[model samples]
Target: MTGLLTDVPVDIDRDAARRAAAEELSDPKYRDARPNFLQQIGQWLGEQLEKLLDGLSSAVPGGIFGLLLVLVLLIVLVVVIRLRTGKIARAAKAERAVFGATRKSADDYRRAAAEAVSAGRYDDAVRDRFRAVVRALEERALLDVRSGRTADEAAAEAGVLLPDVATELRQGARLFDDVHYGGRDGTEAAYRALTELDERCRRARPVAMAGS
Candidate 1:
């Protein structure tokens, strides 16, 4: 039995194989056996997130439950930012002198409207052109200029002096109020309507003067 076992010649290097596997597991260069760069980054981020959550939990009342509150606050912040961006953009475009704030010349408003048209800001174009119409009537002495005079009032006052343009003035006022207060979207066609009315107001002979 001893002679047959010796002739069998078993060739096994278990110690060397074990050493190679241990080196591979410990070596940073052996990415397959060790944590890769992405895995390392994930571990670091996890540690930072844990530390942040711990700090937040200490700052607010309650323990880990505060983490849920923080998450809810983050979501609310995002929603508020989105809403402000959208509403402010709309308000900026719809703002005008008729809102009891700004005042400018007819030509100045006309130029601003033209610029708005060029920039594809149809809402601003509509607002600016409608302001131009009201200012044109004020400049022509057909309508009185006042700080709190609304679009409807301006149309009514101007219509008294220039009955020929009463229809156009009322239409322009409706467009302004629709976009500014009624939350209607301004369109290129609406802007053109105001522009045409402004041109008519420029040439209109007041009822008082037409009779003379």
Candidate 2:
């Protein structure tokens, strides 16, 4: 009773310590092992099915019916998971379709256009400049050009976000179509016009709606 340890007093708030530990374990930012929602849902469904089957096995007094029920439940779970996964895949594919299959960045296309201008390949410059415009619009979420969409379609969509440049965008889109699809050679003036529109759009900001 007279030991040094007994002579010294220690204070511990047991409830506070327990609460701190619980918070540390439950906090999302600190918890490193969070379960995926889909996987957790599947597991919970399986558990519920297992309990139902157990009750059925006891009440119905037959192994065959329980086995059949388990199989049906498993098939249903598989179908649900597959449908969810397929929907997610389709959404991803749709987003990718908006931007098409180009790996080049907007800056890359813009630089290519400048190089084409220097080489006096006015048609090529026009083509690249129009591509740069589309890429920029896509990056800015101004246009959502899906597969098979024409330059005019892209320009029209972008015009909703940038109405001030609608006329120039339409003109630039026509020039691109002419040089690319209509077998017409592009002139410096045409390429210069596209370049000017591209610069304007790059610097332009969206206008606020009247009522919102």
Candidate 3:
């Protein structure tokens, strides 16, 4: 009975039918229903993660725990790579931006810097400390909180507000750029100097502008 249906002849224009189907699919509703680029990327990563887990499931001894350990290690490795490699800036005329995706309060930055110092990661400490200084200036209303503001820009602007600490602000900006963009190592001495600069900026009140 099924073979009889195959034997039936129908005048079907395959090209016209294909074109009709394509026209229907080109509708805005169909296009809107499709996954976006970011969504597609997320789905791809999820599928790859599942595949990796399946391969590890056979060789891993502790069942779920072993698989979870592998997942955790992979996450850590990726994070370490991003943190270490993301700091180096390509050759550009403008200095790199000071703040990153994660923004913190001034005190929070101080706490993070102290932790970095305890871990002997002076580079991290210096970066955090310099951020604290800039954030503190913003909090004090000496500088406005502008997105994508570079270190030199912050220093130059803040220097205008606090005349006494003007020289230190420029120096601090250069130090931050050196360690963060120049791919140079940060030292405890540098961190201390940044801390001193922060203190000076805090102590020195913003001077009144001319004709104000």
**Candidate of highest lDDT:** 3
The candidate that achieves the highest TM-score relative to the unseen native structure: 3
Off by over 4 Å in 3: 1-95, 209-212
Worst 10 residues of 3 by lDDT: 86-95
Each model's lDDT comes to 0.83, 0.79, 0.87
Q: Report the lDDT tens digits of candidate 1 across residue range 1-212.
A: 99998899676699987987898777766656777799999999999999988898888888778778878999999988876678765564445337446678989999999999999988888888998888877777777667767788889899888888898899999999898767788899999999899988898898788868
Give the least accurate 10-residue stretch of model 1, judged by summed lDDT: 91-100
Candidate 3 lDDT at 173 equals 91
Ranking by TM-score: 3, 1, 2
lDDT (Cα) of model 1: 0.83
lDDT of 2 at 73: 88
Q: Kindly indicate the candidate among 1 and 3 with the higher TM-score.
A: 3
lDDT (Cα, tens digit) per residue for candidate 3, span 1-212:
98999899867699988998999999999999999999999999999988877778868978768988988999999888766656532223234778866679999999999999999999999999999999998898888888778899999998887878889999999999999889999999999999999898878877774345
lDDT score at residue 128, model 1, on the 0-100 scale: 88
